[model samples]
Target: MVSTPSPSAAPGAGAAAPVAGTGPARPRWRRRPGWIPAPPLRGRRRVPWATSAAVFVLQQAGTGFAAHNERAAEAVGPDGAARLLLTLGPLLLLARYRLPRTALFGTSAVTLAYLAAGYPYGPVLLGVVVAGFAALVAGYRYATWSALGMLWLGNLLVAHAFHRLLPPGGDPPGSWGTDLFMLVWMVALCTAGELARVRRAERERRQRETAEAERRRADEERLRIARELHDVLAHSISVINVQAGVGLALLDSDPAQARTALTTIKTASKEALGEVRQVLDTLRAPGDAPRAPAPGLDRLAELSEQAASVGLRVTTETEGAPVPLPPGADLAAFRVVQEALTNVVRHSGSRTALVRIRYGAVAMELLVDDEGPATGTGPTGGGNGLVGMRERAAAFGGTVEAGPRPGGGFRVLATIPLPPEEGGAPLQ
Candidate 1:
């Protein structure tokens, strides 16, 4: 009895063998042991509201202290109402991500009211900065800019009015230098917010493009696999079906012919299995060795021989000198020939088939004809073979035509183009 191999006996089985000096392989980015706990790897976490609260508290306290010491501006001193407004302004920022526009406009309005009431100018500006950034990130460009413009203009008017009211010996009020400084500060904030928004949008666009490319690659791979499977299975199964029928018919009267038919079926099935395995191996990891080269036009002789073994006499004729072809075009030419011959064996009911290849300056043409009567039926009963041939040709900027011959049988003709570098060569 045959025995199956054990897991350890399989190639590359068990644990990976150690390198001569490196022991087991370790990932380069693996974390080293340390006292500090590693950060959690969960996707982006929400910012804590306490952080915003802390910033607001510090800014208010510092600003309030600065305002209380200013002798020129008695209106700048903080009171119960100012403290309440400061607290509420930062609190609105906690929901900035979900309601960015609301938070931004609300905070801007609050800051304006606070300034108009003559409150100190410490951390109160932080609210407007944070809200503006949030609004920009949320894609409210026009509204954010409009709000900032109005606020800057209002600040200028308020500062000028307050400056005129200052006592002669009091601390100097808003000046040209201060106005320029505020303008620079607001511009810097808006510029930073705009840059950040642009960067984020670019990142998202790249991610979307990458996903679309991957999806297209997957679709192309699936189409390739389908074509390979259909070609391999259809050709081999067609041969096997014919041979099996012959074997059954001859089993009672001619044991020798029956044995030959059985042998042909076995050979065809084995070849089909090997080709299928090769196609499947393409799906493995990239580090694996490359698969064997796919069969091309050079293998047409073997294909014709296989058809001959199934009682179809397939004669191949070449009209031009051989020329190098791109892998896709080469493979497509071979498949067109293969599927045509398979049709002759399965549906034509004729003893002879003819295949002609013509190489030209810009394209290669294939013509397969049989002398059997036209039956309007294909191998699969729905003309899937013809559809497959057309698709394969179209992939290489080629075309296929399959129809009834004028006199008797069916014929298939295909023309596949050559790439620019390899075209226009004389027959050698």
Candidate 2:
């Protein structure tokens, strides 16, 4: 026989151990891509493409001032075949700095093309260095590091070549200061870009979590309202239907009873209206009240009296003082009992019902036993009535068990747990 595992048993025993080396979970964020954004319609998009494009073009023209004598940036002397590409080749190489990976490959190709044709008016090495910085910002860590390594090696080789080409000790220490400053500027810029990207990612993750929580809260509110409609409003309407029928049946011979039945109908309708208004208040703007709160357990005796007038002979027994419950909890318990009694009158087909309420130190129990067709008079075959009672009890950490009693009739036991006060729920 297969044995059931204990609650504390491991989830996966005698398994392959998840290929021997699985790791812990990552947080909700940090795994997400930084550049991917919510839909364009949801929020503003802030790609750095525009800024990069403009800055790259301006920097390419500006570099000419440092590379050569006062010559305007128009590349190809004056003009030749009016070639837009040939003339723009040196400047176009700045695309390496604007984009990320493969930056060095593009830069080196452009530099070789310029040199093969005759050296350009600008230094080719500048493109390669800017490409390295771009690669770093775009998360191409290995490629960026490799490019920077190659750049350092190339610079050392060029310094050696310059030493051989010029006179002894051609480059002086004064020039070293300019190279150092340029290296510092590149480092500061790339580091700042990476930091800003990380911060933006964090903000978006927080906002997404907040939005999800708001949606969950809205869904819960809708479910609570639906349950209230079933337990309270539906059962009240059932009561009104039976009372109205009784009133119409006796209208010709017993006009006085007909007036009483009409009064019961009006009262039940008003109570339902008030309950609906209370629910609406939550969605309304502050300080708005469509109606007062519905009557609860405090007014249940009055409820029994109304039912008794319509032939549901009810006797209520109170054991202890009523306890203080949450506002909604109090309302729910009252409605459950009211609905139970109403169902008894509509389907039971009997005359007498007993409502016995026991208020304990920590909880309250209500026993609403009735006689239907065979033993008592009330409702008969309603799906909503009994289900509503159970739902109300379940709402407040309680339970409800209902069925026909052996040798007798129908019985509904609704027990509600009170909030703990000292040792138990507070008594009123």
Candidate 3:
């Protein structure tokens, strides 16, 4: 059964989206909008043992120093329970990356408990700040803002209205200035977190663009190589196929004729091998020049000779003064003619093919026709030769037409646009 390609499966469609990560290693999962799934357990990041330990040490030492300096001001001094609360905040941070929302909320609750106990303020709030920053970077902006808001508001009520209901009774209301100071500090932290998120997003966008460009370039290169191989092998193999048949038929009857046919086959296969190697060299060592110059219309005489060896007579006619063509257009034009003649030999019953080239100021036209009752073997829209011709012509902003002519023969016509500067120079 024939399967038609869906619209989304067309050329240049359905390319794989670049994966997340900074290196060339493949990611375990793709990133998506709205939700990000965690990678497999084996791919999960290692627990940040050192970072959690560091935070724990800093919070303990910093809070101890603050308590010693502000003993007279603090409503409660360092105790076993207060030290445990400090340790709990850092422990929550160890899960910050894997579970950002939980870490943020847990650390905030711990800080609130310390404050409700009438403990001194200092780096005791550090764990919550770190968790809030992690949550924001993880794209939980609203949740982080809500958590920070609750922490600040709860501290306010505990220091003033709720102080009497909580620990260390008989304490006076704390100043509003202290709440304002906390507000300013939280704003600065949020600002830094937002900036970090923006930078990370920008870097990822640039990486995705770079990866997409590289994929497009690779696709184009693969297509070019396929076209080169098709044109080279198809034409040469057709000639060899015809000559081999002749050699087999004439081997016993006409030794000289058989020898000539064998010679033609040898030459055709050798040239095919050489062109194939040239195309492959690009893949083997990119950026190296080919051993021979690219073929152009200048090699039409050689092409005619090859056709003659396979029992096809090819006649050429050029109508205006031939001019210099840009290398790309020149190669494209040559391959179109080559493929056209190859089709004529394989599919046309007539032994003769006609080639017409008309060079104009703005464009160049090529016409290849055979007076043929077809051999029933021509391309029926499913072959690579015709498709490659169209692609090559389109690359130069040109067009191609191929079908049976009204006069009962197959015809291939191509038009390639030429640059303005090319109009002034005559072919050497």
Candidate 3 lDDT over 235-348, as tens digits, reads: 998888877777777789777877887898899899999989988988998988888888899888878888777767778888887888888889999999999988877877
Q: Rank the candidates by TM-score, best first.
A: 3, 1, 2
Cα lDDT over the full model 3: 0.80
Clashes of 3: 0
State candidate 3's TM-score.
0.87
Q: What lDDT score is found at residue 252 in candidate 3?
A: 95
For candidate 1, the lDDT comes to: 0.74
- Tens digit per residue, CA lDDT, model 1, 1-428: 12211112111111111010113433556522211121132533354487678768886788767776776445556778888889888888887765677888888888878876676677788888888887776567777888788888877776776655533324345567867877788888888888877777777678779999999999988888888889988899988887777777778977887787789789999999999998888887545864778889989877876776677667778877778888778999999999888887777756678888887888889999998764444443347778889999998888999977878788999988877777853222
Ranking by lDDT: 3, 1, 2
lDDT of 2 at 4: 19
Clashes of 1: 1
Candidate 2 lDDT, 224-251, residue by residue in tens: 6676776666656766776777676768
Each model's TM-score, in the order given?
A: 0.80, 0.63, 0.87
Which residues of candidate 2, in runs, are more than 4 Å off? 1-42, 45-49, 68-198, 286-291, 373-395, 403-408, 425-428
Model 1: residues with Cα > 4 Å off, grouped in runs: 1-51, 72-75, 161-176, 287-289, 374-382, 425-428
Per-residue error for 383 in candidate 3, Å, reads 0.5
